[model samples]
Target: MHYKQLSQQIFKKSSYLCVGLDSALDKIPSHLLKEKDPIFEFNKQIIDATIDFAVAYKPNIAFYEALGPSGWETLQKTIDYLPKDVFTIADAKRGDIGNTSQMYAKAFFESLNFDSVTVAPYMGSDSVKPFLTFEEKWVILLALTSNEGAQDFQFEELQNGKPLYEKVIEQSQNWGSHENMMYVIGATRNEQFAHIRQLIPKHFLLVPGVGAQGGSLKEISEIGLNKDGGLLVNSSRGIIYASSEKDFAKAAAQEARVLQEEMKVYLDQL
Candidate 1:
């Protein structure tokens, strides 16, 4: 889907929320284990509950990859079940050489039919350019992340006196425009959000680290939002696993609604 459509969804739903489908089998409710495909079963229910509030859904690739062939089948079923109007992201963090990157792009964009895929930029331009070739697909490049190890390399100052993560954003803008590219700016790094906003004001930011990760939604929403509502704040454990009981889907909806209501208030002020 195009960025224009995504922006419209945000305003239409009064939310910029992106529900992360890090649906690990071990973490899911015990009741779902009775189903032949527990992972897909859990994801279907979660999607049904959160669809109204979320503009996007990100399925963490690792969760599906771990189960091998059966896992891939389950992932496919979950993808097929999702509503086409909602944006889909393969949280794959995939990036390789140009030719290999092309294969990855095809696998996610053509085969699985995801709207976007998260990519790592350490391999540089040639590695990432292949993914940009697809029409209406997106490459969400990693910039500043929420993990604790992010302080190790992301903050290392470059010769230009800017941090490495900032340089990643600056150099990558030449690769793909605001239309086809986004930066993964961690909600945990909200202090740098204003500066990052100045760097790429119009590009959408796929923000993680809210809720379970302890990132303040209010501060990041204030710092990261552009006139187009350029943020897709993701919540994984906080929403999907809100309850361990049979009412998990209902609990997830409540969590998503709380965030959506807060987002509407913020958007109104914006």
Candidate 2:
């Protein structure tokens, strides 16, 4: 989907919630295991329950990749089942040389038809640029992440006195416009939002680390939002795995609604 359409969806629904479908087979309710293609069944129900409250859905690629070939089939089916208007992200942090990156882009954008894919920029411009070549598709480059190890590299200060992540943001901006590119700014790094906002005020940020990770929705929303509602705050285990029983879908929907209501408050103030 185009950035304009995504922005419209955010306001139209009064939400910027992006539900993460990190549906692990081991974590799903045992009852679903009786069904044919249990993984897809679980995802379908989750999408049905939360689609109204979410503007996007991110399927963590690792979850399906671990399941092997059948896992890939399940992932494809899940992608096909999603609503076209709701943005889709292949949460596959892929980055390689130019030739390989082009194949990754084609796999997600052309084959699976995801609206965007998460990418790592550690390899520099050539590794990220191939993903930007597709029309209306997005490359969500990882920036200041929520993980504890982020301090090992992303926070390292350079001789120029800026953190490595800040430089990643400054340099990667030239690879693609805000219309076709975004950065993965984890919600756990809420304190950095103010400075990051100044660096790229207009680009959308695919934020993780909310809910289960204990990142405050209020704190990130306060500093991370732009005039266009430039944030896609994602909740994975907190929403999808809210219950391990038959009420899983309903529980997921409830959690999503809570976030959506909170998002509406921020949107109204904006």
Candidate 3:
């Protein structure tokens, strides 16, 4: 989807919620184990329940890769089942040499048909540029992440006096316009949003760490939002696995609705 269409959907729905389909085999309800394809079954129900309350869905690639071939099949089936109107993301933090990166881009952007893929920029420009070739697709490069270990590298100050993550956003902005590129700015790093906003005010931010990770929705929306509602706050375990019983999908829907409702209030104030 294009940035204009994405931003319009955000305001149309009065939401910027991005539900994470990080489905774990061991974590899914036991009843689903009896199904031929348990992972896909679980994901289908979750998608059905929460589709209206969210504008995007991010499926963390690790969850599928862990299951081997069956897991991969389930992942593709889940991707096919998603509504086209809602943005889809393959949360694969992939980046390598230019040629290798091209293959990764083709796999996610062409084969699986994801609207975007998460990318790591440690390898520099050549590694990141391949993914930008696709029109209407996005490369959500990692910036300030929510994980504790992120502090080890991302916050390290350079001789120039700026944190490494800040330099990433600044340099990457030149590679692709805000229309085709974005950054992964964790909701847990809410304190830095003021500075982050100054660096890339118009670019979209794919924000994780909001629900189960303990990041505050109000805190992020307050500081991170631009005039276009440039944020897609993701909730994975908190929404998808809200219950482990037969009513899991219903519970998931309720959790999503609560978030979407809170987003509505935020949009109202905008």
lDDT of each: 0.94, 0.94, 0.93
Question: What lDDT tens digits, residue by residue, belong to model 3 across residues 32-64?
Answer: 999999989999999999988999999999999
Output the lDDT of residue 87, model 1: 91
Ten consecutive residues with minimal summed lDDT in candidate 1?
Answer: 220-229
For candidate 3, the lDDT comes to 0.93
Give the lDDT ranking, best first: 2, 1, 3
Give the local distance difference test score of model 1.
0.94
Candidates in descending TM-score order: 2, 1, 3
Q: Which lDDT tens digits does candidate 2 get at residues 82-172?
A: 9899999999999999999999999999999999999998999999999999999999999999989999999999999999999999999
Each prediction's TM-score versus the true structure: 0.99, 0.99, 0.98
Clash counts per candidate, in order, are 0, 0, 0
RMSD to the true structure for each prediction, in A, is 0.7, 0.6, 0.8
